[model samples]
Structures are given as C-alpha cells and as structure tokens.
Target: MEKNKKVVILNILLVGTIILNLFIFTSRMRFFPWFIEDAWGYLGVFLTAPILIGIYFMLRHFHKQQLVTSTNKVIPLFVAATSLIIVFMPTTDFLNIVAIVINAASVFLAANFLFNQNGGKNNYGFSRLKNQS
Candidate 1:
C-alpha cells in the first residue's frame, strides 16, 4: 500500500485500540454493565496485544520507506509501553488519567507526522520562476 494509505490505516487502528481500551476500562468500573461484561473487558485487554504489534509493523514499514524519522519512531514504543502499563497495573484514577493523556498525545503525534510528511512545505502557485535578463 501507499505511504499515506498506510498511515491512514495506522491511525484508524490506533483509534480503534484506544476505543477498545476505553471500553475495557469503563466496563471494569461497571460503567456499562449492560453493554460490556467484565469477561469481555479481559478479552479486550488481551486483544490489544496483537493490535499493538500490528501498529509496530506499520511503523516499521514507514521507517523502511524513509517516511518516519528516528525521533518519531519512539512514539510507538512509548505508546506500547504505556498500553502495557495500563494492562498490567491496577486500575486506579491516576492510572486512568495517565492513560488518557498518553493516548491523546499519541493522536497528536500522529497528526503532526501526517502534516509534516512533506517537511511543512506549502507548494502552491507556479512551479518555476523566470529569470530577469
């Protein structure tokens, strides 16, 4: 797939994973007892492992294409680490807030990456300038 397409897919998957995590968190807290069960919350948490792996491969593909910078590469790792913390750590108010902040940061980073893909160039108007003789 094309680079932009791949990035778009990555964003979608990231959002989906975040939503899944939210569902799991809320369900465990009995926020949506009718919609989601505690058992399903466990299942959702387990499902995130593979989704995180997929995100890593997608980022690796971008790295191979030179579309992603070395510094930007660390975002996904941070995201995965935070995600693991969410899974393994006891669910507390502080941890929930932290997870929300991290997820928001990741979304922002993805947006920044998409916009700066062309190095912030605004290519407009005529392509060539005429020289004065």
Candidate 2:
C-alpha cells in the first residue's frame, strides 16, 4: 500500500481501537446507561486489537521502505488465529488467555521494532526543518 493510504488506514484503526476500548470499559464498569449489550459489541472489541497491531506493522513497513521481518509479520497471524479460535468457541476462557498472550507478544515486537528503528529515541514527533544556508 502507498504511504499516505497506509497512514490513513493506521489512523482509522487507531481511532477504532480507542473507541472499542471505551465501549468495552463502559460496558464492564456500567458507566454508560446507554450501553447496549450485544454479541456484535464484544466481537468488535475483540477484533479491533489485532487489526490495530497489523496496521502498525504495515505502516512501519511503509515508513522503513522494507518488509518487516518474518517473525514480526507472524504477530498478526497469531492474533487472527486466536480470534478465529475465540469466534468458534467464544465460551472458552482458555482461548482468551491465548489471545492475550499473542497480543502481548505483538506489542513487544512492535515496541522493539520502533525502538530499533529510531535508535531508542522517540521518533514520533515533528521538528522544524533547517533553513537553507
């Protein structure tokens, strides 16, 4: 995907994940009187996390001008696999545990990727361009 398009997709995924988290939190905490409990609601919450991780890697790939390492790419696959397992067997608590572990590993890989690329510095900011001498 093109850089600009990938950036846009990443932003959308990020926003969606935030919204999903809010809904889940509110539903669990009974903070929102208008919160409707439904099967689709939980499905959306569960699916957004993996999608966000996948988009992060995709954007990273575009930013670096190279494909992410094979191991890194597998994070999304693991997320998807766990998601499928949960979908097939939503009542199984063990599947949720597996999914959590997979997501945690993906997060670790993403952090490592970012830190390595930026030499352990915060590279997610804007800076004024130097004036031509």
TM-score of each: 0.66, 0.47
- Tell me the tens digit of each residue's lDDT in model 1 across 8-71: 6676666567566655555645555645543355456667756766787777778788876664
Clashing pairs in 2: none
- For candidate 1, the 10 contiguous residues with the lowest summed lDDT are 124-133
Cα lDDT tens digits, model 2, 1-133, are 6554554455455444444443543442234674545434446646665675676567557547653445544444455555555556654446545544555555566555533443333455433353436
Q: List the residue pairs that clash in candidate 1.
A: none
Question: CA lDDT, every prediction?
Answer: 0.64, 0.50
What is the Cα root-mean-square deviation between model 2 and the actual structure? 7.7
